[model samples]
Target: MRTLNNHKLKLGILDQSALMPGDTPTDAFRRTIELAKLGERWGYSRFWVSEHHDTPRLAGSSPEVLLGALGAHTSRIRIGSAGVLLPHYSPFKIAENFRVLEALYPGRIDLGIGRAPGGMPIASQALRYGRTKPSDEQLPDVLRDLGGFLADSLEPGHRFEGVRAAPFVETKPDIWLLGSSSFSAERASELGAAFSFAHFINGDGGHEAVKGYFDSYRPGPLGSEPRANVCVIAICADTDEEAERLALPVELALLLLEQGQFQRPFPTYEEALAYPYTEWDRMRIQVNRSRMLVGGPVSIREQMLNFAGDYGVEELIVVTFGADPAARLRSYELLAQTFELA
Candidate 1:
């Protein structure tokens, strides 16, 4: 991997608002707030919540709503959606929601939008509420409207010429396009928006995707220079063995999820350990492990720094998964110290 001696790497967090078995959604919300506060104190650059629907394991179905509470609880760290599922909602409404957040916490909100459905068809249909499913071809138009609304720059002859995402704050939330492939990278570049690659979801082809974004990038509202970040699953501990132990739950969760077993509140480590596994299951775990960064602090730091350098990105957004909330927090704490984030 390439090395950048002068680059100052940045660290951010992506919370899924994971629900432990027997934990209520209310408890999950409180935990997210607590984690945000702790992350701020620990020197994380940003605290982002993800959107998921019809999944009991993830309580953060409405990242915009959670972002409001996170902004209220944390004084400094930037708060945002890991992303909002753009296809299900109106671009106008999405702009207004983040605009309200920016109005409340100017210069500290990020609006990360994605084209994914974020859930099963049933839940997705409910979100659309009888509306037609948005096609991939519509993303460019959706992004155009979203940007226009945020910047108050809708061109003449546009359908919503007079419409505005009101409360028109001077500082709009920073906008980012989130995706697991080059499609979003190209779109973000075309729109001149910041791009975040979801490496945790799809680790393959990331190099080409990042390169595409950088090559096609143009100056826009966020800044004159190109900006991008890689989001990945990272779990760190004092020792490699312990870190691996802590990561078992998520590994098993992903494996089962791939097998079409959507168990909510994720299985505990003991449960995962107790379950019988065949050779194929073990192989599948190894395959899924390719997308994660798991190890002790020193190892994780070295790997993540190399990952950032290789991708030519200075920022890394980490998502930690485990049944124990304390273990999750500890993982971030270790990473914060390892990266010397502030």
Candidate 2:
């Protein structure tokens, strides 16, 4: 793998559009647009939103719709799905959806695709609506079809030959494969697409998965050189203590999620501070800490850079979660200044 000590790293933001108690979906969307605008001003490279289904705490179920809104509201920043769950939808439809966004926004669009169900099994079943589903092993074929539609390069004699995702615009959205495992890395490499390893979701596999991507990469339409990034949970505050305090709500929320308490919104810091915790809860938090980077500006900057170096990637996508929108916004601001973005 190639690593450069003096590489100028870029930063991107991933918004889950978390809906806390008393917050409506409308409020969540407004905040998403507001954050995208701020992210552009802060010089972040791209602003991506995630898709979640049947989750009351996450308001973003349709990233394509939100990407249209984001593109409309922000003039400079690149907007995309962090990504769209490919398994639940048709490849041609996904290509068409993003193609429309690309036609509307031209050069400022992206289409990050992933194989995850993006929700519980019941929700996944609902997404399929009783249709016979493709096996998990067929994800590669799905990706290939999606790429074919996007690139206008379906192979001769293919089943979907000549079925192009229209309006046939000159500019196509950049496509990336999102994953947290070696399977995704290998698939991305085999397909010659940009890869984003989800370190925030699975921290332990990143270094090895990234290495595997580099080793197996082949030149294709995305680019000859391997393009990859590591996505991680990050929070920054003026002081280390304050940063830890700010992280408490997300920590507790994740613990609850692990304990099968779905649909619960993030709690306030005060609530998290006062909540009684079991020894198991404390242990879960400690174990999950490895996946996050939480500290003051100095420490956060240092750790982010270290992660970039370790992963051999020059770009890092930061995903922040909090009950307070202001805290989440401030965390990105601090990171932007710390890295001197733009």
- Per-residue lDDT for 116-179 in model 1, tens only? 8888889999999998867889878888888889999888999999898978888888888999
Query: How close is every model to the real structure, measured as TM-score?
Result: 0.96, 0.96
Error of 1 at 318 (Å): 0.6
Give the poorly placed runs of model 2, Cα more than 4 Å off. Answer: 1-7, 221-224
Relative to the unseen true structure, what is the C-alpha lDDT of residue 130 in candidate 2, on a scale of 0 to 100? 87
Best by TM-score: 1
Go through the candidates in order and give the C-alpha RMSD of each one to the true structure: 1.5, 1.7
lDDT of each: 0.88, 0.88
Q: What is the lDDT of residue 82 in candidate 2?
A: 82
Which residue pairs in model 2 clash with each other? none
- Model 1 pairs in collision: none
In model 1, where do residues sit more than 4 Å from their true spots? 5-7, 220-224
